[model samples]
Target: MARRGTLALGRHLARRRLLQLGVLTAAAASLTTEAWSSTSTTAAPRFSEYPFSLGVASGDPAPDGMVLWTRLAPEPLAEDGLGGMPNRPVPVQFEVAEDDNFRRVVRRGTVVARPELAHSVHVELHGLRPGREYFYRFRVGRVESPVGRTRTLPPTGAPVGMLTLAFASCQRWSEGFYTAYRHMAEEDVDLVFHLGDYIYEDPINPTSNARQQTVPDYFQVEAITLPRYRTQYALYKMDPDLQAAHAAHPWVVTIDDHDVDDSWAADVPKENSPTPTREEWLARRAAAFQAFYEHQPVRLVSKPSGPDMQLYRRFAYGDLAEFSVLDTRQFRSDQACGDGRVIGCEDRLDPTRTMLGEEQERWLLDGLARSRAQWNVLAQQVFFCQRDFEEGPEQRFGMDEWSGYEPARARVIEGFRRTSNPVVLTGDVHVHAAAEVKSDFNDPTSETLAVEFATTSISSGGDGADVTPATLIRLKENPHLKFENQQRGYAVCTVTRRSWRTDFKILPYVVTPGAPISVRASYVTEAGRPGLQEA
Candidate 1:
């Protein structure tokens, strides 16, 4: 391991050497070009190469509007996060159409692409009809971006037939090919929810056993600054399959620990780490949030203010379902007992310990009680249900998950009981899981109040197997866990007035490309039921 680490460090230094030359060249050219850009008479940059390399995306769907996003990057891997744009703002025209051919154009407008935000545009489109699909595209003079498809959520307090939504999380670029997203692009889902770990902060090491070094010297060092964070998003977004997924469906997203720093809970970071002070960490967090908003289709209302961003919000899909997306980081309490899996830890059982924080917890509970939809889905990152890793005399639990916070979990479970049909959609575990939310997890006879469906990773853990040793052990120990699988894929949810069904979509291999997709299992919950029942 030491030898591999040294070799990786050597490669990174070589990459930095190459980037220095490019940076110097860019710096020399920018001195002249940027000065021209400072004047009001400045025009667009001279682009001999295609600038729409990052592609276009639409997300944060509402009843009448959605957020459209894009960035111009003629040179993607330029070391600088400027995306090869001028210093001044550029005019970008966007249009939304009822049809793919734009014969029935509905809305058209122009927005400025500012250099302050890496020349990215987030056009929050409004005044459109609900429960309808729309095609949108961007243009800059003669150059045109690829057309993207998006849809608004169904009308509230209305009886909708059904909703087909796809959700997944944890897509590490080095793990495997994003062939799962390639398949998801072809799926007929109305919406997609990405529950964080959007990008990993660790340096890429090819000799690592977990995943192959797919893109080496690609921002190889850990991301701490704004430029590094922005560049990371650019690198990940370069995948055609990911771009296809974004173009295909509107997405609702929230970050996990990996988005900023790994295993970082609330204000406190992991024990024995290199982050010097809280101020520095907040700066790192601020950089991460700015880059996230700049690239994603998230709503403008949730924009970051320094170190914080209001990501936890609610969206209704008519009377069929309502999604309450939560942010597990930021205001959350630090993981009890100094993080990681622990057996018999007293800190984890503290009543004051919280996973959703006080404010978000209140908001979520109130939203669940007030929702008119038949299904109230708590969409967020990390596992919500309790899971004991070991069997018999000793009980081991992960502090990173809800299992560590007993009081918080109990309150959330009680809140679900107050709703019509509550369901928790989770990620960050890197494996598929279906479980029953017990009022009292220790008591076998305790009431099952709600249900949870933990979605698997996209390509984070490489080509995962259908049945792994960890899955078998966990299932044997925990009876409430109905199903689980270690596979590289996403989850397809079909919600209706009668029932909420989840299809565990699995791709056995994502090491190369074009792995055959299949449904590993199907589970359902009746309109008023809370526990899992095989469909």
Candidate 2:
């Protein structure tokens, strides 16, 4: 009976997720938020506390629908886990409009902001026209959230004219201000992809921080408990620039290390330590996952199932491109050779040590084989191509990357070889790099299977110089490498049927709030060509 009951619950949750995809099945031309006024707090003061301090966000866009997200945090930086809302469930109303002023409101719905889920709302609006723009907002009593703009994707297997996409990663609060995100908000782009390290795991060193932003005292320690993780996200989300980027466009995000702990594998804790035990580590991971889901504007599919969330999924932009967003931290083998720069480690040569694991590896390869999109991209964290740090005949590789698992990398390369146009979009290196990914990294003359464009960090490391001496040496050592830059910025991709162009946009200084952003370099790869060319 217990097992049967559990199965029934599982079925219910699965149906709930499926329902999110088609929630706006029957939409009224002009819906009203009047229905929610009954449940709203009537006696509350007019200006007791403004709840929308953390701002509003939306993400995970699909052809039919996208997720609209906002959490009711009356006092955002409260010491306790609660966002200063009462213990009871709050009624939150949402509106979707064709115009920014809400003059042409199309969809309106009321959803309960439950206490268990941190008084947040994830309104998945479906049944809308494909490739269309929409504005959304949330209302709780008299307070209203800022209106956010978002757009849906083109229909499946359909061709798009052109796509302006930007990707970035690694935003450490203490390192610098979020000037890159501020710049990104002003760009004319359809969507954004944050490929991980969205929030650093370590606490902010306030004394050393140049930016005068106030990080709450609660987040001064590394996040471990549920409250700590939630607090960390709240503090980061309070930044106006980060909120601006979220409000401007829908984001597709995945987390690397720092969201939970540093360099955490499937169930292994940071630093390869087994002190916490598997069960304890999973519990901690569950808290982190729940906190992540609560804050971000992600789809219901990636919602936490205990410690595990289904983050590795595919997003299609008509027939022009297909983004196979992967989760490298989950289901990956531990770093080989003591987890550092190792020279010729035979342990890395073991084919059995999987990076994407058996399930995700099979899913990725099968998806690549069946995809009809012109450009098939691996939107994921970590470096896809091998990076040998030391300049010598005895090659050295970063143990944390795909280089540590050669056979798995070879499998991915072979799969890419069979595709139409394979491109890898990577982050977590904290520096801009472009490379020709060969089927076999041991032999550069071997067939080039894919081209990789790695974006630099957003504010993880402080302001960076254009080119360091070490970068020059590494570029010389790796002959197949095309470009390298040590600058804080993002990579913008302009995609068409004929070619894909990537511009490495850089910020000279991030230690201050208003730094000038410029294009450091630009590269393009023509159709049928797997290597990069200077634009």
- lDDT, model 1: 0.81
Query: Best candidate per TM-score, number?
Result: 2
What is the TM-score of each predicted model, taking all chains together?
0.90, 0.91
Tens-digit per-residue lDDT, 50-95, candidate 2:
6776777888999988999998887777777777878787777788
The list of candidate 2 runs beyond 4 A from truth reads: 1-48, 272-275
Pairs in clash, predicted candidate 1:
none
Q: lDDT at 410 for candidate 1?
A: 84
The window of 10 residues in a row where model 1 has the poorest summed lDDT is 29-38
Per-residue lDDT value at 526 in model 2: 88
Clashes of 2: 1
| Stretches of candidate 1 exceeding 4 Å from the true structure | 1-42, 206-218
Cα RMSDs, all models:
10.4, 9.6
Give the worst 10-residue stretch by lDDT in candidate 2: 21-30
- What would the per-residue lDDT of candidate 1 be over residues 1-535, giving only the tens digit for each residue? 4864574464344323322322112222222221111223235666655667787788988889999998977776567788778788888777787766566889887788898988889999889999887877766654567667788887777788778889999999878888898788777778999999989877766355243544546566788888888888888888778877787778898999999888997767666545758887888888889989888888888788888899999989888888899998888788888678999889887999888899999999999888888889999888987788886768999988988888888888888877988899999999988998888877757888888999899988888788877788888878789999998899999887888899999997987888889999999988876789988
